[model samples]
Target: MIKSLSVDETDTNNIEADVIVLGRSLPGVVVAHRLRQKFGDTMDIKLLDLSGVVDNYSSRNVTFQVPLGEDDRQRESLDAADVYIGNVAHRYIMHYMTEFNIPIPETLFRTEVSDPPQKMYQYRDGRVVTSPNDYHEFSFLNFFQRLELNNYQSSLDRRMSELFRGRREDDADSRTLRYYDRTSMESDLVSFLLLSESRDVMRLVVRTVCGASAHSVSLLFYLHQCYRNGGSRNYVGGANTSLREKLLGYCRKRLTRKLQQSVEDITFLVKPIKTIRTYSDEQVIVETTKGDYNYVCNQLAMAVRPEELSKISFEERLLSNLWEAVESARGLRPRQTKKFQVKYAEKFWRQRGFSGEILSVRGPILWAIEKPVYSTTGSLEKYSTLVGFLEADDEDEANSREAVLAQLVELFGAQAASPTEYRETEVEGFVPRCEDYVALRSLARTSSALVVWGALDLFADGDLAAALEAGHSAYVRLVLSMRPQAQDFDDLSAMQWRRVLPDTSFVTWFNTLSYNDGFRYVMYCGALYLGYRVFRKYIIRS
Candidate 1:
């Protein structure tokens, strides 16, 4: 049932398989692994990727770091609940680590930043800037006045305040997904942020937050990004690469039945699948672009985007909702995120008594962090380093070396301008793969092997938790479909919308704050901490 296809092997080109999972996304990998876990070697499975790569950024070499911070009150509140309140994003990842018996690597503090944020310099038309150490008039109130010349900031100022000031019931309108879906993020930002000094300062904020220009994203999608990341001030270790390596590795190891095994084993093909067709008998045909072979299967699990899904010519049109999803999908090509990582033999910035974190509205970098390669020590680690990120427009390496050095000289002193070694990459955008979501119900049961709904879940904020849920749901549906005679099956997606994990500090802090506190991440974070101390222990506990 599971046969590799080649031009020479005409007999096996149309061999029938039980299931074919497409794309190597985490969801697809999980589907492949779980189906193998459930079905064993009794069924034929073929995992595929059209890109001929396992990961989107597989070719790019970049070190990952998870940010670490918690709203103080949220941590305490979560602690009192006496349940697992670990990072929801990486929660399933940890589960897979345990299930697969693989160690999740803790990334080192590879970079360091010696300065605290809010030392940020904001510039406008004519490179108008106040020194990092001196933005004396830079409170939330006057910031709009300073940035607004043609009423750009003025337009968005009030709306920005209103967006955050609403109560919980107000945000409960995500049903059509259209409440946040209909408008572009640019139109949303138009009320307040302007491209001051050739830089869309507001655009940089959106890019830093959502990973795309406002024009490319939806307003509600932007809000969810803030809501999901827990208001942006939270932190974690970093994107652990070992989680992925182990998960995929384990699936490959377990799914590949040995040559001695009597049952037909799962097989994988690296070729890009170009077409999919289904027969009335519930059998499926998958073909590659190179005319190497055609595959016959009962089902297909897709882990790619909708637009990519459209590329494969299906023998019959899928469900109307699926077609709508394909048409409505935000073909938003994530913008390029440029970063610079500099390594030093000494922790120079830390020696000067700084946190090494930098945030700027000027140029070269939107934000940068200096982390130590060794996690135990912060200011004195041997592998001292600095990593800087370009926000939006100036992401390209245009005279980047000079521009980076100049900014470093201003913040961390002249010594920082030179490093023993440095690396840069246009890291993948942080934006979710899909903005306007295609409802799963609408696309459900469209074809014999059209398990494409799970891939769209990736667009549901790009959070690993979301993808895990989506993939798990697809696996259940696929199981029920293949075994129509089976009387029982569990539906995980049915209850996905009911779970709620709140970060106490953000909710409490957000409620207490004035509506005018917009784009002031530092100010809000400081106030969150202050409120936690007063309200959590002193007043409430008292």
Candidate 2:
């Protein structure tokens, strides 16, 4: 039987736990799991969320890519040629394969190239490096033969030439030999020979309202996070299923089954709690939608968003400072962010010789992922799917959808472009807004006991994984300090608390330098910096 805990019938005096964790999210779930894993069943731990399960799916489906214009002008020029090469080759091979109904290879690993148009251009260290088009294709064909997919490759090439019989020889050459060969070479070489190469190429760029800018975040931190264990590669179920199903499976596996109870009004204790007065040595009184309750604990852990806490009344005015930090933090509007999943009718995309992924410089959709998963039979077929994420509001959603569809049609033709399903999740207060909150610790007296946690605390430094990690660390320290046997709490040393909490000064420095001038500047510069760093470290790292 699965053990479950519920707040609906919680008794304050009966509350028996060494630790009580409030709120539920990725961070909360992690903290709870860690505690349970380390301490076992000895501690009575309870996790409370107004909503039973944290719905990460709200903003999970869509992953953003940086605009093509952001690439160096010289690299862009090369990519243009690469695009021409890739299209021609892909189109020819796809036509060839289709005519013979040959099964295209299920996996395609394209080579990443970084050749600036001019020698004068300084290539950013760790950016992707691609080979010349012809060489790239040769490498791909070599790999195909090694993998014993040469039959498919030959048939594809032959069919492609036949399809374009009347076209100019150069046009045919561009499509059949140049593009097809280079793409194949790149994919094959990467899979077979230089498997250890770390190109740091930009694969998928996801845009969300995280608490901080991209540059300030550590690259390694996100690689292991964002998804649960096993990382992105293990998460692939195949092209037949949507990404959402896979993600939900991960969440289900890790989330605590015991903490599935609903939180009722009367049983929850609210801090600086309204409509209740505490007597000397009396426990903190709390009022909830369900009823009234009291909590007696040596210490408290607050995991609520700062803005939400600001609405409550507090006896001491000093508490307002915490709220001020929260308001100053960045946030997102509900309708501004959207998530989409688009599926292709068949695996015919590869027959056209295109990688499953595409980035548009000036298109309605910013990025597309091809064949995100596989089928039961293990054959790459017409049932392949592509997932696309676009930035749009309710008013622009329809137009954006149409625009993305048109782009797909242009790239893969009408037969390959069709919508399976589209989902929109309106997330409010989504962006990171926490850097300043971390800095405020400097201004806070060592005697201050109140500390706030949420997006404001996490995003202040512009690193989501770091922020979440830091938040967890802070909670651990706070809990340790409050322990009866801990030296700081026993001795009442303010200095000890400083060492336990974050260095507010460092947080402030990052907030000021990175998120200066509010949301707009952060949106353009801060986010881009964060995205690029993440791409280099997590997405591209081999």
Candidate 3:
């Protein structure tokens, strides 16, 4: 029951909805997915998007695929690595998979990149931090494990818990939050992580995850994001596009599944939403980019970042706080990110006795991992892929792949200088990456009918799990606000909305975070940029 906009449907102004959700982000999909399960065909839900589900991150590197025999469709399934954002192990995705009875593949980690515990390095100020055994190296995980920076880790966890927990907090948590909110992540790192080595490591993690350099981000705000994704341990997004693709595949199936009947009850509008205005009867009108359609609905849930929201117009102007939120979100935008994959003759790093994961303070590329090859057959795949994230500011810079290869020389020696085959893909930063997060916090005005909801950053930061919580929360708020008085839906039990698999177990409990510290790893995010320059440039020039 999916319909595309047709000529007859253009500018109809008759499109109706019990619920209208904007943005095709993971949160929006989850929100609609939840509604489909709860109300089934009974409730009319319309989801509109200016982009694809999960936004830019989904399509950036997906253009090409690995080859096998003669078929390009012979996809290679890679082992889990840290490519996804937040909790790869306990994916909220499991909910849809289980509900649909989709089989879950056991995660196989091909950690051995070489025999002698593969070598890893930290390049800073023309120096390398490594073991006396030239080949002995560590993943970002192992480097911190050796340092044991427990105190700093504990402090960060405490700050996050005080700020981002969903339930009501005591005065101590409130005071803790106020004290930390005033400082930036760089300031806190300098004060808490004493060793220059520790700071160097800490800098990378802060930059990559937070999207800007540590100095630019508020410590309070960053911690709130960490908390939303279920504390520090949950940050794992595995290789390729497995996680997102799976989620989307299942969601689409659920959307198209027949319940009651209509020719194409679920409509997926591919174009961007141009303007959103309100009319006399609390009706929200959504105009599409091509003017091919107009959607009229009573409620709106913007499951997008704050900046994305400003793209649309509202009947009444946004108040200062609301406007300020959008501006602040613009400041937190993700930096231009590029990931590269190189095919090697064999698992060279594993032979050297190391897991091919590298986190750097200085990089043409920040993080590197030995991602497993996508193999259709259950046979030993000899061809290996080395995937890494690079700091590409613009088209010219991103196209200069040679700069990254030079860095690899320093990391793995001359043998690493060249791969049998090398290719790189750039991922555009999500335009609304952190927009909804900023707006929700700064919003001071409220409307009875037209509203936006979802996890911009629930508890101050948003990620996959928080996205689910945000979607569910938005649904709850909609039901509450749309039907203020006791209504037919009031009697609906909360049990119906419960996900088949709740993420509570994998999420680190607030009361439980102990402040143990360790070595730092990950990134040193570059300056913020609107999109991946190389992709746009290539498209334009082509």
Candidate 4:
């Protein structure tokens, strides 16, 4: 996926495209595919990809498929992978697969035997407790403690569901979303949950799910992510099959060859553009670094990060509040996370009657799931692996085989001491949270001819679901620009409506101020007022 193409400047003249999609990541591909499906031979869409830049934030590469013969029950395991598909993602993906006659992966089609087919356990107090639900298994928690946990979880779920209960276009829901976006997940948890234990538990869940601390993530973003993925229940409901892998696998297996033969071209490796010159909304002139190539296109879809977009110079017409947001986003550091897999000779945890799915509040390791190795004959292998995330930022520490294995030994037993092979992958350059949701709202309100959405954008919610959703939004924006009379736009087509931001507003902060916060503010204000009164009455008169 990281290869450069060196072409002569004169060859740029051959690049005649009606639409040019920048960044060939999952979102970019989906946008192009959707466009091609609608326009057919009428439009010439070209994919322009930059090496090592696109898909750096994606978790898709974390997990992959290793086929077990020609059977449907294909052995898809983790290099270090995490995929969460909620109702929204599942519905759209299923529709897309059905339309294209692509085979649905077995992971998505599995039947639910119980309340939850997969059981998740949390590592706590030198023992493991069932997570989110299954109260009977929570032996570590007292009756009262369990009650508090259950209450906190229920409230969280209700709030997540209520975020978009009505319609995306509804004024009430919009306001609610804005209010949530104007607040941090940390703030919400601290205010809503009474106990610090409850707060810590919630924060741990947020970190595991979103790969960022609760304080750094907006409440709206977290809720929307959970809601979109089906709900908070399904969001933290253990590991699911990799949707991104499935989609990409289908494209590589079925569509790549066929697409190459069509009018649309998947230009995998292209040099970075020097400038994007637009005379009108319908006319786009893209110049390469050498200025030897001029790719003339009618429209442009930028599925790149803000930093990437900052590289290319564009005319004033293409600039808006979104451009300003992009300027602000370029300087923001993305959320970072690391993935590791510990290969062991035996399933030691399973021997102790544990499911091997472990979550921790304190960690170098935050969340882990058992990944049993499978032979080509579709039988289980003696060796098994524990795949999960590392909370460490330092490269040496994250990649440290001993540090990870030591933690495993503490959690499991002495049996976890010897690992056959240890592997680690560091993932960075994720979508960072904006300073406030008002910024996102302002950006969303501003419409532009150029459709832009990125997997690494500040406004992005930092998940494959968001990328997929935003891709369709980009396509809708492009389509609406071309055909204003088009009535087929989905309810989720508006990108502005979905792009969430952090709650950093002073006004919002004051409005949702807690009893403790209100008391402190009142005390500080009282002290200041008293000092001012004394100075004015005595010092000024003298």
- Which has the greatest lDDT? 4
**Candidate order by TM-score, highest to lowest?**
4, 3, 1, 2
Instruction: Residues 143-261, candidate 2: write the lDDT tens digits.
Output: 42222222222322333333233343234333333233223222422332322221101111223212112332222222212222122222111111112322112112212122222
- Each prediction's whole-model lDDT (CA): 0.48, 0.34, 0.50, 0.57
TM-score of 3: 0.67
Q: What tens-digit string does per-residue lDDT give for candidate 4 at 1-542? A: 33344445345455677788887655676678777877777877777776545332233433332332442344333221122333665555444444554554433323222444234444445455554343223434666555555655555656654455444433445666667777888887787666665666677767766667888888877766666655565544334432222222332333222332232344546777778877656677777787655777777777666667668887766664366665655555555566777777777776665656666666777766665433334343334777776676524443557767777787677888888888776545353363554455344334356544433233232244455565666677677777666536452333333323333456334434444554578899999999999989998789
TM-score of each: 0.64, 0.46, 0.67, 0.73
Q: Per-residue lDDT of 326-372 in model 1, one digit per residue for the tens? A: 44443434456566777767777666655555546666676555542
Off by over 4 Å in 4: 1-15, 52-60, 64-86, 97-127, 130-140, 169-178, 237-268, 372-383, 394-397, 434-447, 450-462, 484-542
Q: Candidate 1 at residue 518, lDDT?
A: 46
Give candidate 2's TM-score.
0.46
Best by TM-score, which number? 4
Error of model 1, residue 170, in angstroms: 16
Worst 10 residues of 3 by lDDT: 518-527
Per-model RMSD to reference: 11.8, 22.1, 14.9, 9.9
Tell me the deviation in Å of residue 336 in model 2: 3.5
lDDT of 3 at 185: 75
